[model samples]
Target: MMESAFTRPVARPLVVFDGDCAFCTASIDRIRDRIRPDVDFAPWQRLDLTALGLTEEQVENAVQWIGSDGGRASGARAGAMLLRRAARPWRLLGTVMLIPPFSWLAAVVYCLIAHNRHRLPGGTLACAFPGPNRV
Candidate 1:
């Protein structure tokens, strides 16, 4: 496995994902296997979305990263935070992804992946987002 700061409990940030999505779960599993961050994973269904100031639609659309200080990052920002916590090379890559043009592209890619996830490997028809809603 890769050795990194995240291998230990650096901050124990929470990664809230869609439990209803097989694709999302599989992706998370793959990330765990590769990075092994000392992060806590929880399904959106099992968490208090209201307490987190989140709605079902929000989580259904993208992954969420809740920092220890209560800072929140969603979509590509969340992905970047997770990747940046991985080993050195990955951290550098993550940093690169956060730059202007790359960041914009990453956000677009993240949205595309999320929207079409149900059609991807390990995903079912139910894995699609339920659309937006008012909080």
Candidate 2:
């Protein structure tokens, strides 16, 4: 099948997320609208995971970052990668996040947030989960 507007490869980095979650959607919107990073974001539901070298289980859990070179990062590392591409302050923080204790802390924090996102502001009932959210 021919690639439509949504399925083609991107020259820029791509951020894969779960569109079914309101919190996730809000977060991405805020960042894209306000921060204006040089990245492309797509809800995994509308894109082909296999073409993007992603898995349903991968995107269903946390946000994902796919660099133009096909490198991938998820969760906090993905966030860090995004911030690193942003202007000034965020870039600084992203760089720091790649460091020792900060990276570890960011990872832990990301997991916590990802699991509890359904309870966060802007979250919806469809995003709810009872047990562990990770796969």
Candidate 3:
């Protein structure tokens, strides 16, 4: 039987992201202004990865969601959680996204974007894979 590891309880959901990536920072900025959730944003560089039960590889690959209940989700799931935090139609979209086939598709789309994020708006070669290790 497999045992779980993440157990730290958060008072609110926290988002762990790659701070070194311009694209990531810009995306977060847009989300913050638009969604304005009570969620906490912590760049992996400034956070304690061990305390969060995270690794360099995980943060490097995708954004992560750490819920108040200690539930953890990554990539598209993480994005979905943030969308749910948004207002109205975006929240509704988030709800629909988490369902079955849509969830599967969301994951695929997330991976594609994440992998090529360096090529996205505001991104640079600095956002490339095996990106800056400031932590």
- Most accurate candidate by lDDT: 2
Query: For residues 59-105, could you state the per-residue lDDT of candidate 3 as single tens digits?
Result: 88889998887888999999889788778888988888899899999
Q: What would the per-residue lDDT of candidate 1 be over residues 1-135, giving only the tens digit for each residue? A: 112223333256788899889999999999899887666778888876777678877787789987776778999999888887788787887798889999999999998998899999999988977745634
Question: Using Cα atoms with residue i matched to residue i, what is each candidate's TM-score against the true structure?
Answer: 0.85, 0.88, 0.86
What C-alpha lDDT does candidate 2 achieve relative to the native structure? 0.85
Alpha-carbon local distance difference test for all models: 0.81, 0.85, 0.83
**RMSD of candidates 1 onward, in order:** 6.0, 3.3, 5.8
**lDDT of model number 1:** 0.81
Q: Tens digit of lDDT per residue, candidate 2, span 21-58?
A: 99999999999987788888888888767777788778
C-alpha lDDT of residue 66 in model 1: 78
TM-score, predicted candidate 1 vs. hidden true structure: 0.85
Q: Which residue runs of candidate 3 sit more than 4 Å off their true CA positions? A: 1-9, 131-135
